[model samples]
Target: MAAESDAPERGAGTEKLWNETGIDPVELHLGKDSGYTLRAYRMSDTLPGAKAEEPEPDEAEDDDEDAPEAEADADAVPEDPDADEPDPADFEDEAPEDGDEEEDALDAEPEEVPVFLTRKGKLLVFREPAALVAYVRDNDDHDLAAVDEYADLQERVTEDDIVCDEADIYELDLVVANLRGGQEGWEPELLIKAAEVGRDLGYALKNDSIVSALAPGSPLDDLDEAFRVVAEGGLKGRFAKRRLKRSDPQQAAIAWRGVIAKINDHVEWRG
Candidate 1:
């Protein structure tokens, strides 16, 4: 009876807002700073203003046309009249093979990626829930405002509604420490959550270092996969754990620390 009484106190009423909108609140703890922000995922081709920007033509090409032409060298070798003429077939466009077309289609598929509430490529986070609510309600300039559900959220959300689920709360501060503690002391779930958020932020912030560090074949990704395997608990997991034992703990800790620092550099805290 006592635990059930904290429904509104736990912001249960506001949970539906996120559920329906498919946008979630996330609490990020960066050791020295912590804040709340909104994040969502969408297909790359479906995101607002997602069109590719074409590069402008270079002025150097035009300058070359205006410059005086170089004089032909008198000492140059004369062309042989008997030489075979170049084949016109060489310049013709070749049709792609069936397998090549299939590969192209696969490569062109739109990927789903995280998008944060941001203003001018900088994520907008607030130290206080009220300030985050206020920022959401008052500002229409951010990337989140482009969503169809954002208007509904703006009208409905309050400071109390800004409360996030425990699952969405990430304690990145503890990542490096946990890694340096060695395989036996590592917490699988914590490291998994850190990887999830790190990947999301890597996409949201479009930071090259984060993307490369957390890429599918990267060392950090390998560590994440090893932790995932250990958490599953099976014969395969046993082998994965053995592999993890052989891995260097300090190297992983350093890599994660560098990624955390890169993320910290892009953060802008309000309130």
Candidate 2:
């Protein structure tokens, strides 16, 4: 009888504390034999604060415990710009692989696409060696291997690749024009390679001439301009003149100066 009388007073105190602290009680009902048990936690824990998060290392401080959440919330956001940034070391690591890929690509002797991009990438497209050989003679397809062997003469003969002749370069220019999609101007590397092909074939100014001819003019005039350049002296001519002069003393002073001018004329000139 005495314990039952004390229950009301205990209940009153509990109610008062709940009101003061704004904490709700969760009555977890156990088995009927166990009866019910009441547990209390801050109401915020189950209400507006349910989604509240912890702070991150880089966040600033704030008075409210919830305020620390602002920093945490910001941290959840993604930094997209940082995603695109690359490590400098990546290029160094990839360089050897890239070189190997290039060598394999070359050695694999993939059929050249005439100005058509390689499956590897856009930068690798050139006048297909087969096509260049074919351009010389229709049946040269059988002879392409021989032509390629001839083209490689620079490596064996001069320690460097020879340039392509103008006729062949013109064919390459045609191939470049036929390329389904590519930037419409001549790339210097392409010019250099064309010249190499010509040199290998024993055409003095053919490749360089073709390259100059392909230089872009107005939107519609590019192809026509290329034709003119091929007929006239293009970079190939300039390169050939310089080469001839370098090999010959009489034309050395004039030829070397011209070569310097030609080198300067091309954007690839480093010296």
Candidate 3:
């Protein structure tokens, strides 16, 4: 994506320091707290430690994440004839022919995904611009420090350059309320922006549950697409409106609530 060059003006204008730098300051409103952070998108292969391993199963989740020990109720446990010799097919797939897999891999294109100013997989946000600027200038241990654009950030940033585009300011705190308002009250701009930010956070933070919840073709994603179509306003938009009318607002609200909770758990708030 092209860097946004024309950000809406603030104090001295939407601080052009980030413009064309492939990084932008953003304000996030979650629950009752609002904070400022930095985010950027880089090619998957180009990002430091880009290929995050599949996350281990959640400790709190059952069945979906992991099953309880069979020894807990040995008397009730069903006898399994094939438990001893597990099927090889269930554990792993047959390796593809040597050069064919390599050729296809070379032909595939790398995609761009979001990365944030995180440390040890936790997002770092600041309550004050001065704090965030100081951290950026003094800290080199954070994940973003490995990116090419980060050098410019260290050399050029100041407290005044911490401005964010209005478009980049996400009000996630209000997403649940808007969703609970039902179809008539749904705000396309608000819902769409929430989805965009959630997707970025999910990938950037390596939260598999969040990624799965908002994956393409999931119910929430379908809702996002419908809202986008309705926002477009045309004959198709009328059909989309009918679709949105059938969608459950409460379900959407709950799903978003879970994603927010997961994100809040991983946030490292600073002042």
Candidate 4:
């Protein structure tokens, strides 16, 4: 069969469909908001009456700094009787100009450097991701991965291949240059270096291993001397009696388990 007229002619339900598509029958009839329209205009027929939102009132000034510096300046400026002071009227005009410029500069977004940071000693070093990448690119001695590795540190540590933020580089460089004494000594310096490399990337020290290493009497003895006394005592009494020593047999047992865990988590035991 010949294709019957597949078009909406002049005056069928065509006008109704066109309205839905944002095309008004009258060319310049304003107010047409339709999903299909090329131009966004709200049709008067579809709109509902509603009051406009009122602008909010100015907020109360902050005690710390939200108060304009002009007020502070006025309060702070001393009355110099001997010295010829500038005109007060002139000061008002100058204040707004200076304040406007300062406020403009202050209101402007800060220049954001692409980096993160963590602390080592008294210094906050730029952290990994951006800082590490930049450091590795500049220094021939360190690789990218090593830079990443060192930047991850958080606590007591040491690693050879590391990158650091400027503050850390300064602090660690100075500390290592002039070694000192105390409980930290070498360990602290080492940890400082490690923090620069990657503070977070650390072998989680099993508290048990530390406890075991700290055993009394002999340097070699892994168990605390109190272990024997506690072992002799019943569990509760043993735990209660422990002051400077291990009293909980269960905790001791846990430490033994920690030794095993330490061995498992150790990075160098595969061979």
Best by TM-score: 1
lDDT for predicted candidate 2 compared with the true structure: 0.30
**Which candidate, 3 or 4, would have the higher lDDT against the true structure?**
3
TM-score of 1: 0.79
Rank by TM-score, highest first. 1, 3, 4, 2
Compared with the true structure, all predictions reach lDDT values of 0.84, 0.30, 0.84, 0.30
Stronger candidate by lDDT (1 vs 4): 1
lDDT of candidate 3 over 1-271, digit per residue (tens): 1113574466543356676578899888887677899998888778665465666566346555465556557758687987787677898977799898887786465788787998898999998999999999988898787778798878788888787887788888888989999889999988898899999999888899999988999988999999899889999999999989999999999999999999899899999
Worst 10 residues of 3 by lDDT: 1-10
Query: How much is the lDDT of residue 106 in candidate 4?
Result: 60
Predicted candidate 2 versus true structure: per-residue lDDT over 1-271, tens digit per residue: 1012222222444444434533222111111111111112222223221344668645534445446666788789667875767888877753467778888766544332221111111111112333322322222222122323323321222101112222222122322322222333333333344333322222112235333432345212333334335445779646544443223222322322333233223211010
- As for model 1, its CA RMSD to the true structure in angstroms is 7.4
User: Each model's TM-score?
Assistant: 0.79, 0.14, 0.76, 0.15
RMSD of each: 7.4, 39.9, 11.4, 32.4
Residues 191-250, model 1: lDDT tens digits: 998999999888788788898999999999999999899999999899999999999999
Tens-place lDDT digits, model 4, residues 1-271 = 0112351233434333333433221111011110100111232222222234445444323344476778778789677889976778875643467777887876453431112221121112222324433442344331111223322332212222231212222122222222223222223333233232221212122234534433444331323333333435687435634442333334433433343333224222100
Q: Name the weakest run of 10 consecutive residues (lDDT summed) in model 2.
A: 28-37
Candidate 3: how large is its RMSD?
A: 11.4
Q: Alpha carbon lDDT of residue 159, candidate 1?
A: 82
